[model samples]
Target: MFGMADMDPTGGLWNWAASSSLSGERVQGALAGALERTVISLDAEGMDGAVLCDVYHVSGDFPTLIDVYLAPETIAETTAASAVAVRLEVEIILPDDSLNPTRYVLADPAGGLRHVHVDEVETDDGPERRHVRPCTGDDPACAAAPEDKAA
Candidate 1:
């Protein structure tokens, strides 16, 4: 089950938790259902097309917190423009594990979903920087785009 803890014009955060006896597949289905419900609610409130920015387990426990970051997209040229930084996090978790957590799932305006992973690499300047890339075979629920699948 899940519940929304906070919400605002910019975004919202929700918490999801399931029983330990539940299978990983069931957990995934529940998570997807929660996301779908959230989208519907947001759309009803005129906040459609909000992008999911982060998902992480709370304190390495059962309840997971998901952060959805929303920003208005300009369909035409406007006076002011703003930028938002997106960071995706990736870590290994078994598919059969009941608490499977994903870093981020981006929902585009075209209704396309992109799963991405973020890695930190050490640069020449001796600083670690995050690099985001598409989800690989190891990731759970990772799938190719519709066009790619058709080809």
Candidate 2:
């Protein structure tokens, strides 16, 4: 089971590109590469067996959300040892589908999850990229409406 202590420090990197103009495929590729490097670094630190990582995309709205799930113990241990250094150049792109807004849920072994909403809005300056506030239990945007559920 994972807890706050098990969360990846590099998690913020997930939002690093919250305000860029890249394609969803490109963003996914970049994240996958970063995650690969993280795994390799862990292996180099002789902690390969201590951790496992997975990267997958959830399609919804523009600015598709990519979820990176890592084994808990490895993150805590490797972070404490300062073994992984992750650097990323971030840019966000809209998903192919324009029907729904994108929301990414990153879940750990214990079922704990974090939600990230990526979206773009038209502004006087052109298009502005932003992350909607993290979803809460009462946030209608966080989940489908009651009618949606009934349907």
Candidate 3:
């Protein structure tokens, strides 16, 4: 488990764009269905592993549930402060039946996983969303001696 970061107002950079008029009941139902269907699909593919789930509902807006699977070995080290950095070698299954075979890192100050490439991704049933902050080793924030927070 990771330490929970205070809800950062800028965290929406990594969030799905949800409609503002959705009722709480509707949002809950959709989130439940998405979670069930996704988990089942992943299991059928023999890729069932530990999952990290995040459900966000900032203020009174609609909610979004984001899930990712990270293997134990991938988590390099975690600080007491709940800061974790990991290199994930995996394929991101998009709703459009496309796969992004990219190495991602979970370095969001708000504890979110993000693609290293900053690009718009089309999902199977939603508006395209952009991946935030593409950080490489050369990025000062990603280097050993950090100067300022990059992402």
Every model's TM-score: 0.22, 0.28, 0.21
Q: Give the better candidate number (1 or 3) by lDDT.
A: 3
Tens digits of lDDT, candidate 1, 3-39: 0112132233322221122333333333334344322
Task: State the local distance difference test value for candidate 1.
Answer: 0.29
Q: How much lDDT does each candidate structure score? A: 0.29, 0.35, 0.30
Candidate 3 weakest lDDT stretch, 10 residues:
89-98
Error of 2 at 129 (Å): 1.9
Candidate number of the best lDDT: 2
TM-score of 1: 0.22
Error of 1 at 110 (Å): 2.1
Candidates sorted on lDDT, descending: 2, 3, 1
| Candidate 3, residue 25: lDDT | 43
Better of 2 and 3 by lDDT: 2
lDDT of 3 by residue, 37-127 (tens): 2222223445354223333333211123233333133222222111311111111211210133222333333434443433444445433
Worst 10 residues of 2 by lDDT: 78-87
